[model samples]
Every structure is written in C-alpha cells, then in structure tokens.
Target chain A: MSKDSNIQIQINHKPTHLPYSMTLAQWVEHQTLELPVALILNNQFIPKGEWAQHLLTDGDHIDLLSPIQGG
Target chain B: MGPSAPDSWNLYDTPMTSRLWMGSSHFPNWNVFASACELAKPGFITLSLRRQTATGGQSYWKLIRSLDIPILPNTAGCFSAHEAIQLAEISRDTFETDWIKVEVIADEQSLHPEGPELIRACEVLIQKGFKVLPYCSDDLSICKALTDVGCRALMPLGAPIGTGLGLLNPFNLERLRYRFPKIPLILDAGLGKPSQATQVMEMGFDAVLLNTAISQSVNPAEMALAFLEAVSAGHRAFKAVPMPAQPNAQPSTPSMDMPIGDYRVGAELYGN
Candidate 1:
C-alpha cells in the first residue's frame, strides 16, 4: 500500500475490514451490500440517492441509523 | 333525602375534545401500529428525530405518509431547554412542520419534566413561531407559564414514562384547570386504560394523548375504540354532570310507615 492508497473506515465504531479503493458509487452498487436506512459520512447526512455518486476514502467514519419508534 | 338532587352541571361551557394527538413509540409491529392508528384515527402522530441508517430508503417517513396523519414533531429526548430548542428547529426542518411537542425531561428513569426547562423551551419556541405543546408534570405553575408564553396547549404527564399509570395527579390537574380555563390541557403519557382517559376528560381535560397503552393492549383496535368512547363519555358527562348524590343521615326506608312496596329493597320482599 502506497501513501496515496485508500485507507480503512469505521461505521458506528465498527471496524471496517476493508477500505474502499473504489468510488462511492461503486461501493454502494455492490450487490451484497444492503441498503442503509441513513448514511452519514463524517457526521454528514447524505441523501440515499447520492450513494452511487458519492465517493469513500480511507479513515472515513460512515454512520448509519435504523428507523425506530421514538417520541 | 334532600329532595332527590338534580344534575348540577351547566348546559354550555364544556371543554372541547381535540380530534387527534398521538405519541410515536411502543408498537410490537408496524402492521399492528398501522392498523391500530387507522382504527383510532389520530390526525397528528408525535415523533422525535435521531440519526437513522441513511442506506435504506426513508421508511419511517414513508410510513408516516401512509398513516395519512400529519407529523406532529416532538422534542421528546432533549433534557435541557437549550437542547429542546435546537431539537424543535431540526424537527421542523426534518418533518417540515411547525407543530412541536415540547418535552424537557429532567430524569432518565421516570422522565419527568423539569418545569423550568419547559418554560424556557416554550418561551423560545413561541418566539420562533412554533406551535408548542409543552409536556410537563401535572403542575399548574408549569401549565400557566407555558400558556403565558403563548404555547398553544399544555400537555401534562399523568405519571412516569411508560409506567402506564393514569392521571396520578388529578388534584393538581384540577387546580391547573381552575387557573387556566381557556388553554387546552391535554393529559399526555402514562395512560393505561380507557377509564383513566375518561376520568381525565371528566375532570375537564381538553384531550388525552397516549401511545403504549393502546399499542400494547391485547386488542389494540378494540382498545383504541374504547378510548374514543371513554373520552367522549367523559366530555359529555362533564357537560351534563348527570346528578350528584346527597348523603343523608336518615335512612330512605321511610320508617316503614307510609310506602310499603314502591320498589324491592332486598332479596326478601316486604309485605308479600
């Protein structure tokens, strides 16, 4: 891995096993990946429609939350 | 027997019951939630926002639309008045509504209201042009402050969070009613049965707001309908005050002198 190589990321503090050397679009399009209820990159709320075009990098903290009962 | 007391309640000046105000928590399943709400027919479903999985579609929002009810956003989780103010803004933006159920929880376990924080939040919310409904303990001071600050209504808690107790502080609520006769007073949270709701309404509460009681009932659809009827009965009774019983020292048996058998007194018939 060179200095410019994509780095690993964590989600909801879970250690991501792999770093996406791919574009954000490519990573989301992977058939095995389930659709996330909500995507957060570095605490940013990303629209689901932008998943394909959004890119992921090393050390990016992506967070997801499930819609549940709250009031 | 005090001349058989007649009904004392006045004909008019009855409290008006609100159509719909719901809490969005505690349903075992989405299907049941949908069915129960449909049967209950609430116009507003209360909710507070937390971060959710952005990967999936907006299922919660979609379901809210499917429920066909207006999203009555809430600041339920916020503890401080400052936090509640911020949450209300975000709720308005996210839900796209200015209606906010202001909840300023001071305790984690019971989730009772911090009256000072509630007033603080209501002050800011009213300034911000939000239709605020502060959920506080059954304290008349808090209710009066909320109304003073221009909150649309005051939603006083019946008991602790999810305790399912009903109108534990009726005395205080009565005082609250006496003070603020104009503002709508809704009993929010901790309602376990329809009778509890009826009692609150009978005491002149404008409405009843609940979630878990109806959602967790053995038959949610039936329970919802029961609440509907109970609320209606309470409101009507408040207006009608059917009659008040007079406790007299003398027995109504007439000293066995005049009327022998107008009605049966007990299992044994008299003069038969």
Candidate 2:
C-alpha cells in the first residue's frame, strides 16, 4: 500500500475512497444527491450547518437518508 | 340549500378540513398512490426516511412534494426510544416538518408499542420542539402518559398493525375516548372496512389514519374514496346527534284520537 493512497470511508454503508481530504458539504455537492437529505455520521446526526466544517475521516460510517413511503 | 359548513378541526393549532389521514405506502404503483391521495384529499399524509437508494428515492420524494399535503414522517420500525428520537430528528431535517408519528415497537408479532419507551421518546421529541404523535395501544394509562408528556394527539390502534381486524376492543377504545374527551383520538391501524372507520368516527373519535386498508385493497383509489366518504358520514352522524338506543321499542306514529278509538276498545268490540 502506498503512503499517499486514498482515504477510505463508508457512505450509506458502502465503502468508498477519497483521493484527498473532503468536507462533508463538498462531498455532498460532488455526489449531486437529491435535495432534502439528512446526514448521520457514526450514528450521530450532523446538521447541514456543520457539514462545511466537518471533514470525512478514515473508517467513518456515514448514512445519507431521504424520504420514502411509510405508515 | 347551500353546502353545509365544513367540519374542520385543528391539529397542533393547524386547521384541517379532512378527517381522514392517509399513509403513503404499499400501493401497487406510484400512480395509484397519487390517485388515492387526489381522491381522498386527506388532512395529512405519512412517510418515512430510509438510507438513500440508488436513485435516492427522488421519484417518491417528488410525488410526495407534488401532493402539497402536510407531511407527517414516522418512526415506524424503531424499537427503542433512542432509535425513535434519532429517526425523528432525521425525519424532521429531511421532511422539513416537526410532525412525527412515533412508534416504538416491543413485540414483533403483535407490533404493540412499548409504552415506556414511547413516552420517553415523546418527552424528548416534544422538548426538542417536535410535534409528537405516538402510535400506542388502546391502553388508557399509556395514552395518559403520552398526553402528560405533551403529545397533542394520540393514535391508538384498533388492532395489531396490518391485521385488518377492525377495532378488536371497542370497549377499551370507548373508554379511551371517554377518558380523553378533549384530546384528538385517531384510530391508527387494524381497519379493514369503511364501516369500521365510520363506526369509530360515529363513536366520537376526531379522525382516523389509514394505510394497509387502502393500499392493499384491490382498488386503492376507490377504497380511498370509500374511506373519505365514510369518514365524512361518520363525522356528520356524530355531529347530527343520533338517537340513543333504548331497551324497549317506541312507536314513531302519534297515539292521538283515531277512527278505531283505542286499540283495547277495538279488540274488545271485535271479540267473539
């Protein structure tokens, strides 16, 4: 493994690699996710206001949740 | 005559015209769900949050938004207070609404709410400025606890979820209504027929929340209309002051002066 290899994190439980450090806000914009999404990092809710300052770390578990049919 | 006044009611200070609240789930297709919503014109529609799918549930979200009804997001599958509270926060953020249907299931088979956990969740959610509506059993004590914790509305089940049994314990439900006469009691689940909805409404329940009955029906839109009409009829019947039942039958016609005089005299005159 190269020392400069990409950082690994989990998005919606799926492992993904980022070439460089990225803030949650930038990652969200890069993914172009649907509007009205909620972010949960390691089971803690991360408000949209904090996404800009919050950086994705190695082995972080993130959940991107959206609305669906329910009863 | 002109149309009668609408029997509008308030939920958390928001006035609503329809007494029927529909759930957005289990429809064969999205078009059917949309059609049902258009037909029913419910006061509120329920939905939930889930981890993003491949398409990110964009189509579902688009349809829900287009409906233009107040959204009520639920913690349907949460089993603990912590989980329910967390899901509620996520729901509030995603749906942009503080209205949450809190369900903390204790038994998988019965799908009964864990009263303690539910009350706990409601307390935190209400303190957090969320309008909490807990789905509980027909237990008066649990209902009281929920109301004590600042739940403005209570949704007690008619039966187990998706059972379609239709108000298994009317006695308990009646007591619940009697105990909380001022609180809005919405029958939540276990309804299979429109008559059941009407029955509860006639029994003085403020409203009903339906999902499986309409969604799993052979015709979702038609069933939705049926429930709408039933709910309206029930509301009208309740407001119209229906006659009370009596142990003995009473003749509708007046017993005033008649050609045959009295029934006793006629019977005596005709006797052999």
Candidate 3:
C-alpha cells in the first residue's frame, strides 16, 4: 500500500482512518488500552488470542470495552 | 459461645468468610475506594463496563488486579437478555472470570429487573458455564424462575438502585428466605445504611452486596468498616438465637419464689 493510502473504520462508533492492512493486534498495540479488554469487530467479538491473526479492513466497526465500577 | 465463632458460606462452590460483597464506584477518589476495599475486605467486588474514551487512561482493571479478590463483572446498563448476554461474554473473555452479576433492567425510571428476560439470560449463561448471579426483585416467582434456569445465586434488591431506601419489603425477603432456605440470597442495591445491611443479614439472608452505602458515605472507608462490623454483629446475633417473641409479658422474677408478706398490714401502711 502507498504511504498516502488510508483504510476508514469505526472504533467504538467513531469513524477513523488507519494505515491500510493494519491487523487488530496492531490497532490494539497502537492504542493505550488498559489491559484485559474485550474487542468487537463488526458486531462480533474477537477473542484476545485471535487479535494477532484477525485483520481490520475498511468500514469495520471495532468496540473496546473494559471493567468499570458497578453496583 | 463467644462472639468469634467461625462461620463461612459458599457461592458457586467457592467458600467465603465475609458475606459483604461490595461495589467499586462513586467514591471521592480511587485512593478512597482502595482504602474502603482494603478495610471492608468483601467476599466479592462488583464491576461493570463502558466504552473506552480517547482520554480515558486510568484502568479500573489495575485496581481490581491489585485487590486479589473475587471479581464480579456486571451487565448493569443492558436492558435486554441479548444485550446482557453479549456483555457477559465480553466480560468473561476480558476478565477471564465466569462470574457475572446479571442486571436486566425493565424500566428506566424504577430500574427494576426484567424478570423474564433475566431468566432467559440466566439460562443461556448457565448453559455456557457461567456462574450467574441474577440481580432480581423480591418477588418469589421471579426468583424461582431464575433458580429453575440454573442461577447460582439470587440478588434481590432492598430498594431502587442508588435511592438508599433500604429494604422496602422486608416481608418479601423473609418469605423468600423461609421458602427457599438453601438458596444463597444476597441483598443487592437500595441499601443506604450499614444498619440496613445488618438487618437483612439478621433476617437470614446469606449475604449483602453494597456500593452506595459505603462508597457514597461521608467517610467511605470508615463506612466500609462500619458495614463489616454490623454484618458480623448481626450474623453473630442471629447465631446466638434470640429469644422468641411473646404476646404477654413475662416477669424475670418468679412470683412463687418471692418472700411471703405478713398477713396483717402495718399500722402505717393501713393509715396510708
């Protein structure tokens, strides 16, 4: 892919442009995620073990969730 | 027997000495929350999930990891079984723990648990090997339905969430306990004071899950300690076997054992 090439995707419902052919693992490593997060790609959960193998393409929806305070 | 009698209960096959399960939210700061958790030493800590913000760098997982206690991830905001099931799966995957506090709210105003949806969720989650703890109302039929669906424990609310109303229907709780003596019933939500927690414990509830009562107090840590003491005291009092209630008053001293009085009244007594 050329340096100017970009892949548009939605993360947690926000649209963003990323480097083409970026794997889910790469996307995760690039972000400052608190450890032990669950990821969803296009409404389907991608387990932590498969992040390295799973690839994110254009127009994909990614959701990252972590534990917060609850009663 | 002394006050320090040993007692323990099990939830989903895990033995725990403390019956107080706490929530880690609404504290003045994380430091106060940490202090409260350390002091309270609850049997389980309840947590939830939300979207990670770009600026959200702080990790509650760090706090949870440091505690080394049993973590119960909740499906707090989910309104449907499907939504709750999805969150439960994600929570299980992320936390690597099968324990979940399932809250399927029916309405926005009351925040009451949707009984039928909760049963469906419990059925699915339990089939998937999740140790489900369904947060339900004090209604017996709903509780029975959850149990039928294989929920490990039932968390009946004492009042509306965050209202601090505290055990709106004690009779229902008592009836539930009496009917299902073996079920592990944890009074969850609506408790505003340590005394309310103690009262529920005294009524034979296996445990109590509290958050606002401790985290929202003037002194969170101190309130946590107070809850600990109150739970212990109430449990002890329950075990001590309080005297049963009676319709008529009974005198401590026996009339037959009293000293006999002289047959004739004294001159001064007669005059009076």
Quality class of the docking in candidate 3, CAPRI style: medium
Per-model lDDT: 0.71, 0.88, 0.85
lDDT score for residue B82 of model 3: 98
- lDDT for each residue of candidate 3 in A7-60, tens digit (9 for 90 to 100): 898878899888657788888887756566778888889888889987777788
lDDT of 3 by residue, B1-272 (tens): 55566688888898878888899888898889889989989889998877775435255678778988888899999999999999998889888889999999999999999988889999999999999999999999999888888876899999999999998999999998888888899999999988988898888888889999988899999999999988887777777767899999998877664445533444456764
Tens digits of lDDT, candidate 1, B1-272: 13323222211133322443566677766677787778777646776666544444355556777787766777777899988987677566545667888888998888989888889889998899888878888876677777778776788888786788887888998888778786777788888988998888888877788788887788877887888778777877776765667787767555664455445643356553
How should the candidates be ordered by TM-score, best one leading?
A: 2, 3, 1
Clashes of 1: 15
User: Scoring each candidate complex against the real one, what DockQ results?
Assistant: 0.20, 0.64, 0.66
Can you write out model 2's per-residue Cα lDDT over B95-172, one digit (the tens) per residue? 778889999999988898898999999999999999888999999899999999899889999989888999899999
Which residues of candidate 1, in runs, are more than 4 Å off?
Answer: A1-67, B1-20, B55-57, B249-272
Ranking by DockQ: 3, 2, 1
Best by lDDT: 2
**Interface alpha-carbon RMSD, every candidate:** 5.3, 1.6, 2.1
Clashing residue pairs, backbone N/CA/C < 3 A, model 3: A68-B48
Model 1 residue A22 CA deviation in Å: 15
Chain A vs native chain A, TM-score per candidate: 0.65, 0.83, 0.83
Candidate 2 accuracy as lDDT: 0.88
Error of 1 at B149 (Å): 2.2
Candidate 1 vs candidate 3, lDDT winner: 3
